[model samples]
Target: MDLYITEKPSVAEALAKYFNSTGANFKKEKNCYKDTKKNIFITWAVGHLLYQNPPEAYNPEWKNWKLDTLPMIPTIFKKTPYAAKKEQYKAVISLIKDATTIINVGDPDREGQVLIDELLPANKKVKRLLLNALDETSIRKALDDIKDNKAFSGLYAAGDCRSEIDWLLGMNLTRFFSLKAREGGYTTVMSVGRVKAPTLALIVNREAEITGFKTQKYYNIFAHLKINGVTVKASFVGDRITAKSEAEKIVTASKSSELKVTDVFKKSNKQEIKELYSLDTLQIDADKYFGLSADDTLKTIQKLYESKYLSYPRSDCKYLPTSQFTDSPNLIIAFNEAQLLDVKIPLPNLRPPVFNDAKVSAHHAIVPTGKIPDLSTLSKNEKDLYLLVLKKYASIFFPVYEYESHKVILTNGKYDFTFTTKITVNSGWTALYKNMPVSDDAEHEQDNEVEISTAVKAGTAYRVETFELKDAETKPPRRYTEGSLIKAMNNIKGDTKESNNILSKIKGIGTPATRATIIKELIAGEQLSKKGKTLIPTEKGKNLIAILPEIITKADYTANMEILLDQLEAGKIPKQKIITEVTDFLNTIIKQKDSLKIVNKDFPCPTCRKGFLMIKYYKDPDTNTVIEYAKCNNAECNQITPAKNNKPKIITCPVCKKGFMISKKNSKTKNIFYACSCYPDCKTVLSEDDFNKKRG
Candidate 1:
């Protein structure tokens, strides 16, 4: 019997349909679909049925976070079936045992490769089915060109190393920090991981920069002059003046009311068309235009791919393979027929920028699969995102934007002033976005572009009508939005000696598929937050960074690890060597754990006056909702109270007269409200002011 295993049931179903083309039907069983005529047994795993064992699984003593049991490094790593997916794992194992040959039909990525590779029996003949798209044509093509399973051994190694390394670091550090924080009277679990730590550090560092920023008041002198019956606004050569006295001096010196144009410069420039959309760039643009978060953009695009309207969405490559260029005309024809494109301009000739095989990695750039779907069937967000992908596809075929820039320098009695203007000679690709709102950054970039008098010439003198002083203050750096954070993560370069060589060759801090997940985890762990598009670090997050060593918080550390993973994938280094190095590093850090200090801030427990309060997180098993709270230190008197932002106040509930009111914040919406302390019983909620007034 020939066995076919897929990453998901949907994919298995899709593949089963093709094999059941004959009159001989497919019998749906408890765990698999059997095609009797073709002698094929098709089954699927719900992502990964197996995962790395936690520290507790290695040894019972490692279950509790203790200083003496720090750095629980298992001499031999092990895998266990996810409790929720054990049935699926057993089904796959049973099918593998019965089959003469097994086919691995997983996603075309390192994680996907490892997910199936770990489950296979050494004696069975294994083959790989590399399906790029779920469409019938792509799937059939891949079926006809299956390769030996051994071909993906390197990818399996890379994925295995990544999982083990992450498990080792996450389990050890999370335990170490959580235990250490107990000394400071902070009882909440201080979770830390290889990727998550550096990612959180990025937010915390940005928050520091924002908080430390000092606003400085400054002034700029502007001159309104008339030249050839036209009014033009010019600014002093040295723009900002720190002192009002200096600005006043410029105004006083300009009392002559005459200015001479010392020099005029004009030049034409063109902005090259942007490259095609990689996952990161696509997420950034979608966030900029449609206000979609990085996760939302990724989810929507992934849906589009599964729906066969687009190719694989998790690609990091921005350039397409040269062979794909040959198929571009057909794709363009399909796009046009779908009425997806709004551009009326003629498509330009195929250029090298759009197709370069050298730059193509595991996957090519994301583009339309030339498979059009019913427009009405897609949701508003899906339609918007699909259109975004289509526009970027169309953009490459449009002419570059061309404009002429003009600059003029004028001289007053003792100072020189300057003016500039830009004339659009051609809209080019920019015409596609003529209807959209100008981006905030684009508007700022063009702030200096003003209307200029055509008659103005070099060495010509004109009368200055008046001098106006504009007051401005320095603004701090803007907080990271999900989009900008994605960009930052992608651009983070290693500057530390330990990571410089490794990280310099790595493209970004995280892969295209994992960056959104990293951000999502940070938010889930209460280490980071989202206010609209802006990402903010929570008090817990700030505290975690405050206590964490520089090595863990630095991007270089994670970047170096990623480079090693990449090297593992490329077969440059053995997995054991990397594991050994990581183990030694873990041991070194574990020894120094004693030297780390945590500031104790425990307060006497209000609920149980005999005990002090320590931070803790509680999850409602029914809802799977996690809430951080303060708990009494005494084991016998286990009284709990909400923590930090949601900590209860002295106010009495108006609705539930017997209970006190506590502030409760919605995790997703970030809205604050007051609820009765006796939740699930006296479920009373009030406005912040109302609660405060009631307390008063």
Candidate 2:
């Protein structure tokens, strides 16, 4: 019997169903999907069955993160099944023992290449089934073209190398820096990562650039010309006027002049729907349209995928399999039956170019699985995300956007002015996105163009009416919003000199699968704080980057490391070498003499500026419970409050402008209320309901 191991339950069911259609009846058993006559027993791993052994698993002494035991590098990493998933692993082993051959049906991605492959029993005949899609037809096609599992050894090594690299750096460097922080009287546990370090560095560096930007004043002369009663606004060109006097002179001189149209250029262009959403693009759009965090978007998409409304959400690839492209008509039918669209747009008799089998490197782009979901049962987040995908899916059936990009140059006796605008020929696919916060298309900004009469001749003259000189200063670089930050992460091209001329070789810091987690982790660590849509680094975040070596923090350097991983995947480098090099790098950093110093004093109170808060875990003698609290050091202000995730739950007071809000439990009601830290000086208190309702 051939035992098939899949990464998840859905794939197992799909594979079983496909075989069932081919004259075999598959029954849902306790552990494996059983088909006795067809000699197939399919089992699955719930994500990763085994995890990398912790520091203590290697040496018990290394369990505690200490400066003395720094750089505890294990030559050979060990693995153990998770305590919770041990039973599933046992059931898998039980199935494997009775099978003659095993079919590895992992998703055809880097991580998937190794996850299911790692679970197969040794010395058993193993074959690989690259099930790119869960559709029955795709599954049958994959089964017929099954190859030896050894063919994916390189891909497996790449994924394994990436995991071990993260573990090595995360364990040693996080411990090294965190221990150093602890020695310096800080409670910060620095969660470092190979990819995360560079991501944080990018945010920190961008903030610095904004801080150092110098504002420069400039003047522009705006010419308002009334041609055939249609007023068109144009800005002065050629040399920029830095002096207000020069700009005013031009405005005064051109006020009474007749503006002659020097040149008129118009070119018709067509824009089709954008390529399907890769996880990166989808995350970006979700953030832009709905202010949804990349992490939240991924979670919502995952829910949609599991609910069968969508395909794989973690896929990096955005191209669909050719078979699935041909299968799109059925999906259209399903979506229509499910009433997926707000308006019933006409489906054109055309095939989209997004379908190419060769382009589907991993799982195909996230798409509808032709399953009708109960729209009423979906959460707001789920519905919002589904709509986002639905729009893109439906867009391919619409006509291309046709527009005439027009530019007109106007000239007086001494100065020349120009204005550019687009005249819409057809609304096409863009009609779906009207009145939305659009992605940064160069022509998308309203300020980029002005409307003009399409009938105006090249040599037509008009009176220069109501011209003005506007003075403006160059603004500093804007802080990165979540959407723009994700775009930056995905677009890995750096300046040639900055990236050591390897600009074209590397793609990004983190994969689509991990970038959201990296950003969320940074925010959770209090290294980053979100103010509105923009991200600002906290003092702790700034301090950590200050002491870190250039190699760890620079994105290009990490991107180079990503290039190495790609090489590892292509069999250009050995996986052990990658691990060994990282271990050695950790050793050098741990051996450094300088100590990390943060500007913050010893637990300065987050609420009260006058006092410091000391965190302590207390044991209840009667209840035998261990609970943590932050107690103020000032004897007069002896305030004891429950610890907020090992830190004080300090919020700025809404009533009192000078003090922060501290949680106080009422002795009578046993309910929490927020009180001003200033207390008697500013006796402002609010109920817990108000506390939860207030925004920071």
Candidate 3:
């Protein structure tokens, strides 16, 4: 008899229902069921059933902060004992005790591998069922052909290596920094991990870019042409007229001369619709269109997918396999949504869903279940997300969108004017997106709409309708918006560029499941703040990175570690090798005591209300300040004020001498209290309504 254990109760229940097993018993604490004929029981563990603990567990005094315990490397890391979990742990142990055979049914990835391997008793015999998608078909197949746990020894090694590295570095470095600071008031939670540090660095780097950007000026030449009494717009190619004199000369040259059509090049092109929404891609789209954070977007999509309104949402692949193509029609039948399932889904005679097999990683791409979404029952946000999924699925059978592209070149002797236009030959899958407008923050926001003129011969001539010099400026790199950041992390851009090549080699900074959490952590840590859809680093964040060692803050270091992790998983390198490397790296960073600097800025302290505030920058021991109230630095007559706390809080107005309170929540939550910091002299105060409407 074999007992299968899954990572979550939801998945176990799903499998049970799909099999139509009778006399199944469900318990939250035990999360198990019995298979009467075989006397086998199936159970589950919430996320990770076991985890590494603090060094203090071994030596009580080790809990205390000290430089002597700088590198606390454990020969063998301890597991979170059943004694701690008490109830669930007891249930699992009992289930294991009675079982002759155990099947590990965790997610098909590193984290899942660790969850199962770490919980097993030392001498227990176990097998692994590597199931990627939590679907009935996938689950049944895995159960029938269960592989020996030994087959996945490489995967477990990688997970073990990852855990050990995080523990050695995070535990030791956090302790090293906490004890060294003068505030001696240790940070309740000062974390440093492989992904966390580099994630924070992304924000710190962006903040520097925003602060150092300097504006520059440039110019261009423009013309408004007339065709059969209708005006058509055109511009000079490239920055052909940067200087004022050059622009004026081009404008002057176009005024009198005939706009001769020196050359006309035309070509017809076609574009295949994008495949489907992977979780990352969906999150990127939501951030651009709905201003949803990556975390929020994931949550919404997960709900929709689990509710059977969409296919699997955690997929990394954007294309489906060819094997699933024929069954696509039956999958559509399960959908209850009226938008689709009602209309005949066109099934084009295309190759199997399988394309290049190498493109698939842990799972296939996200798709619809062919279930029609009931738009009326869904929230506005849910509906919007569902529609995105539905449209992408429907587009699978769509033909390529064809267009006739024209490049009409006009030369007034030396100064040339060119007109380019695209005439649509076929709408294809674009029809699915016709009702949806382009997201406001869409990438590559080029002007797609152009006035198409009648085809011109190679040597045609026409009069110049209008001409002028248009002033412009060379803009700096755009800030890191959630959409663009996701793209960067995924390395979705083309290869050939060096920076992109570097990004491609490295696994993404965080896994798909953890990326959203990482972004949330940055915001909660106050390292990054949202400026509309863009994530800009805070002043404190910049200073934090400035003080840390270069390796601690750069993406390249994280990427290199990722390479090692891959090697560990393939059995090419031992787990201990990478774990040792990370431990050594953390120790080197902690010892760089003299390389640290902290930036302090002054503000009227919110906590004390009378003194100027001194912001503490670095977390390392060398930089700590002792200032209770936000106070003025003057020794003789120190004035202090209450320092503002984190997030939305109440504050009194300094100007107008009014005793009103202000909060930092959404505009609807703002009060009328905030005023100028000039005290009674500048008696200016704005109403809550007025301030709420003010654009930051």
Candidate 4:
């Protein structure tokens, strides 16, 4: 039997459809689709079914975190089936064991290559299929041109090194900081990771800047002048004045009512359409236009890709390969037939800015599959995003935007004022968006308009009607939204000179595939919160950063590690070297863990009067709800008491007005229930449904 393993079930189904299209009789089976005549079997794994073994897997003593076992380095890392995905693993194993030949049809990336390659049996002959797009044509082409699986061995090695290193660092550091914080009387789990810590630091640092910012008052001097029956507004040439008296002096110094135009520079410029959508750019555009979070936009685009409405969504490249350009006319025809194109714009003979093979990696920029989608079937957000991608793709065929820029300098006594104006000579590419809704990107909007007549010459003199001094204040830096945060993560570079050049060349912090997961993990761990579109670090997040070493919190550290991984992927470095370096780093962190100090406020233990209480959080397994508590520090007395929920909650008990409703678990059954905090005395309990209705 010939077996094909894909990274996702959707991809498997798409490939199965392609095989069956040529009159190959294929039938869906228990865990795979079978084509008996062609002797082919297609199956998929639900992402990664296998993950690195937890710390406990190395040794039972590693299960309980203690300062003595601070650095638990596994001599030999092992792989095990993910607890939640064991069934899928078993099915895949069974299929692979029985197959005579195997084809690795995973996504075209390091992670994808490792995910399937690690599971293949060494006895079976293996081939690799690299698909840039999931459309029928692309799928068929890839199927016809499969390569040896060993071609991607370097990618697998890089991925393996990354996974093992992350596990080692995350396991040791999370326990180290968590226990250290506990020693300082903090009860919450201080979760830390290689990528997550630095990402959190970004938010925390921004918040600190916002908090410590002192607004400075400033003033601007504006002069209103009339030129050829048109009023032109000009501002003082230099920086804003810090003192009101200084601004007043400038206004007073301009005693001459008539101002002469000393210089006028006019030039025509052209602006090409914005680059095509990479996952980062698409996420940014989605957030700017529709207030969609990075996670939401990724999910939507992935769905569209799986549905065959768009190409791959996790691509980092923003340029199409030369091969894809060959199909541009067909794509345009499809768009026209689907009414996605307003005007039938002919494809330019010369190559546009969007085409370049040098910029294409793994996959090309995200574009439609030329498969017309049913608009009615798509959700509102999906339709919006599809249209957004379509418009960007169509823009390359349109003309370049042409505009004439004019800069004017006016002199009033000692003060020289400057004004600028722009006139659109031709809309060109921007004409496609004439009827489209305005984007939320502030940079997309034209600057302040200054009306000027055509008759006005460079040497012409105009009368200054009035001068106004405007008071302004320097604003604090804005907080990161999900979209901007992703961009920052993608663009972040090392701060130090040692790793600056290498880190600058590589993608920042996380890969396009993992960035969404990183943000989601931070949010799930209560390290970050979303208020509208802004991502704010929580107290827990801030505290984690406070206790971590500077090296762990800097993007440079992670960027340097990423560089090593890239080197491993390119075969420039050995996998064992990366592992050895990580192990050494871990040992150093463990040795220095004792010196780190965390200052946590202490509370007297209610259960044990002799011990100071530490704040700890307990997550209920059944309900997945986290409850904070005050835990006794004494090992002998080890008593836990529920901490008060001081944060504002919408739910309050009807029976006892003084107590709020909190989620509590049944000690014996381990079932979650909502009950009044007054417990034994008031004894008011409700189910989740009842609580929701009562709150309503």
lDDT of 2 by residue, 1-696 (tens): 889999988888888788778878889998789888777798999889989999998999998767788787777877889999999899998888888998888888778877876776578988898988776667778878999988888888888877788788889888887767654435768878877777787789899999999989999778887655666778888776798888888887777788788898878899987478889889988987888888999999999998888888887777877776667777777777777675555654766777767777657787767777787899988987888888887777778998887787878868888877677888787776765555553334655376544645688787877887788888777787777888887765554464644533334777788888889999998788899878999877887888787788766656556678878878888877777788778878888736544334446765545676766677979799987777776667756655656575556777778787777789998878888878899999988788766632
Residue 93 displacement (Å), model 1: 3.6
lDDT by residue (1-696, candidate 4, tens digit) is 899999888788878888888787778887888988778888899889888988888899988889898788788888999888888889899999989889998888888899999898777899999876555666777878999998888889888888888898888898888888767776567778888988899999999999999999999887887765767778888876898888888888885667888987888899997479999889888888888878889999998987888887888889886666778888887787777656765676777877875666777788888677888889988998998898898889888888777888888667798888766776787766666666665544533356343634677888888987888888788899888898888877667765666656667778777788899899988789989888999877887888787888888887677778888888998888988888888788778766877645345443345766566677979799986665567777675544555222336678878665666678998876787766677789887678657655
- Model 4 CA deviation exceeding 4 Å by range: 13-30, 83-88, 134-145, 212-214, 225-231, 253-256, 337-348, 374-378, 434-456, 496-498, 566-574, 601-642, 646-696
Model 2: lowest-lDDT 10 consecutive positions:
439-448
> What stretches of model 2 exceed 4 Å from their correct place?
225-231, 334-339, 342-345, 435-444, 451-455, 494-506, 556-574, 593-696
The root-mean-square deviation over C-alpha atoms between each candidate and the true structure, in angstroms, is 8.6, 6.8, 8.4, 7.5
User: Candidate 4: lDDT of 461?
Assistant: 80
Tens-digit lDDT track for model 3 on 1-696? 677888877567766665554344433333576667656677888777676877987677777777666677777888675455556666777888878888888877788888877777767789987765555555566668888988887888888777777777678766654444323222333445556676767666666676688766667676676654556556676554457887787677668666777876889898886556788888888877677788888888888877877766666777765445656656544442343433445665765343333455556777766456667888878888887777677776667788887887877787677777667788777776766756775346544236454555778777776676778775656787776677666663222354345557544666677778877876776567888888887654554566556676656665666668788878788877887787778778667655543323325444345543442233335556542323344344353332333212224453444443332234685533345445455656655565444412
Runs of candidate 1 with Cα error greater than 4 angstroms are 1-46, 82-95, 102-109, 127-148, 225-232, 255-260, 337-342, 371-378, 412-414, 442-444, 451-466, 496-501, 562-574, 592-595, 600-696
Let me know the TM-score candidate 4 reaches against the reference structure.
0.81
* Best-first order by lDDT: 4, 1, 2, 3
Residue pairs in collision within model 1: none
Model 2 Cα shift for residue 286 (angstroms): 0.7
Residues 588-626, candidate 1, lDDT per residue (tens digit)?
Answer: 878877688664333665544677666666787979998
* Structural similarity to truth (TM-score) of each candidate: 0.78, 0.83, 0.80, 0.81
Overall local distance difference test of candidate 2: 0.78
Worst 10 residues of 1 by lDDT: 439-448
Give the CA lDDT, 0 to 100, for residue 244 in model 2.
88
